[model samples]
Target chain A: EAAVTQSPRNKVAVTGGKVTLSCNQTNNHNNMYWYRQDTGHGLRLIHYSYGAGSTEKGDIPDGYKASRPSQENFSLILELATPSQTSVYFCASGLWGGANTLYFGAGTRLSVL
Target chain B: AQSVTQPDARVTVSEGASLQLRCKYSYSGTPYLFWYVQYPRQGLQLLLKYYSGDPVVQGVNGFEAEFSKSNSSFHLRKASVHWSDSAVYFCVLSLSNNRIFFGDGTQLVVKP
Candidate 1:
């Protein structure tokens, strides 16, 4: 079974504060992704990494940055958090292939006041 | 660009009843379709997927989905509904270059 863990299951931060959401996967997959879930809009990709030291922007990458320092870890960073950024974020990892199945974390709920 | 659409926002069914969730996709070429379920406060889990071969594919928990190339649809179905089957269902499409798109999702509510 694939395991993807996320830290700070719940978080609260003030506006303009810096927030970092961490994720770790034990599947040893080559692809990692960050996504935000909002009501009515579903889940939108924020960022993804192909491997260590490689990060790429997804459809919604504004005000967000990603870091992949190792194959087991991927982090999503918000340099300046805003109330609009308050949402449930999910981390997923999958093997690189034609159509891979992504294993996801429980998700981190962020609240910015 | 590939896209997926789940027509129903929510569905209600009684225990031991039949269930069907509609999903449609838009893609020019061959498309890879998938159905996922997300329980409360949990990550999404793959229910079933269809790439080629048989149009109907079975998944865990007795969930199955049928793919239709003519309609560009992949709808999920189950013979009997249970309380545990209540969850949000998402239909996804996998495009070229490994890019995937998901539908807004349909919430299933089971009543005893």
Candidate 2:
């Protein structure tokens, strides 16, 4: 099974503070994704990377920046955290072709105060 | 625009009853369709996926989904429900570019 690990399971950040959510996958997959889950919007893709040092914007990438320093590490950066950013975030990893089934991490619940 | 839509926001069924969650997509040609289940406080896991071949696709945990290109639908079905099966199910579409789109999701409640 593919293993995706996310750090800081729960976080509280003050308004205007900077926050970073880290994700690491042991499967060595080339594709990694970061998504935010809200009540009605479902899971909106924030950022994704094709491989190391490659980051691409998804549907909703306004306030988020992504870093893929290596094959195993992918990070989501919130330069200026806001109340609207308070939501559960998930990190997933998968290959580029075939079924492209994604393996996900537990999740990180972020609260912006 | 290409998108995925899950009409039912929530569905309640008895533990022993059958279950079906509807999913529809808007796209020109056949795209990769998938059903993902998210347990409480966990990330989404792939339940089933349809790329081509048989319209009826089987997934983990006795779950299955049928794709209808004419109807633009890929509805998930389970013969019998278990209380543990209660979770949020998301319908997803993967375009050729590998950009995935997800629906709002359908929360299934199985009463024991």
Candidate 3:
């Protein structure tokens, strides 16, 4: 079975604070992604990583950045948090080949107050 | 860019009743289609996917979906739904590079 885990499941930060949400996957997948879930809007991509030392922008990558230091780890960083940046974040890992199968983490609920 | 559209935002059904959730997509060529379910505050679970061959595919929890090339639709169905079936269901489309687009999920409220 594929597994994706994220830390700081629930976070609350003041405006202009820096926050980093961590994710780890056991699938050894080569692709990882960060997304946000909001009401009336589906999962919107924030950032993604092809592999270690490679990060790419997604549909909504303006307020955040991504890091992939190793195969199993991918992180989402908010340099300066704002109230509008508050949303439930999800991390997903996909296999390198064969349809790019994806497995998602439980999710991290973040709040910027 | 490929996109998915789920027309229904909320769907209500009684236990032991047949259910169907509508999903429409806009993409060129043979697009990958997927249906996922998300319980409250939980990650999304893959229900089914269609890449090629059979237009109809079966998934866990007695759920199934049929892909229609003509209609550009992939509708999810369940023979008999239980109370546990209540959740948010999303339809997605992806091709390569591990980037997929999702539609605003359909919230299914199965009343017992």
TM-score of chain A of each: 0.98, 0.98, 0.96
Give stretches of model 1 more than 4 Å off.
none
What CAPRI grade goes to candidate 1? medium
Worst 10 residues of 1 chain A by lDDT: A94-103
Model 1 gets an lDDT of 0.95
Ranking by TM-score: 1, 2, 3
Ranking by lDDT: 2, 1, 3
lDDT by residue for model 1 (B1-112), tens: 5788999999999999999999999998888888999999999999988888999999999999999999989999999999999999999898657898999999999999
Candidate 1 residue pairs that clash: none
Model 3 Cα shift for residue A104 (angstroms): 0.7
Ranked by DockQ, the better of candidates 1 and 3 is 1
Per-model interface RMSD values are 1.2, 1.5, 2.0
User: Which residues of candidate 2, in runs, are more than 4 Å off?
Assistant: none
In model 1, the Cα lDDT at residue A107 comes to 99
TM-score of each: 0.98, 0.98, 0.97
Clashing pairs in 2: none
> What value does the lDDT take at residue B81 in candidate 2?
96
> Candidate 2 lDDT, tens digit per residue, A1-113?
79999999999999999999999999999999999999999999999999999999988899999999999999999999999999999999999964689999999999999
lDDT of 3 by residue, B22-86 (tens): 99998777788889999998999899898989999999989999999999999999999999999
Deviation in Å, model 2, residue B39 alpha carbon: 0.4
True contacts kept of each: 0.67, 0.56, 0.44
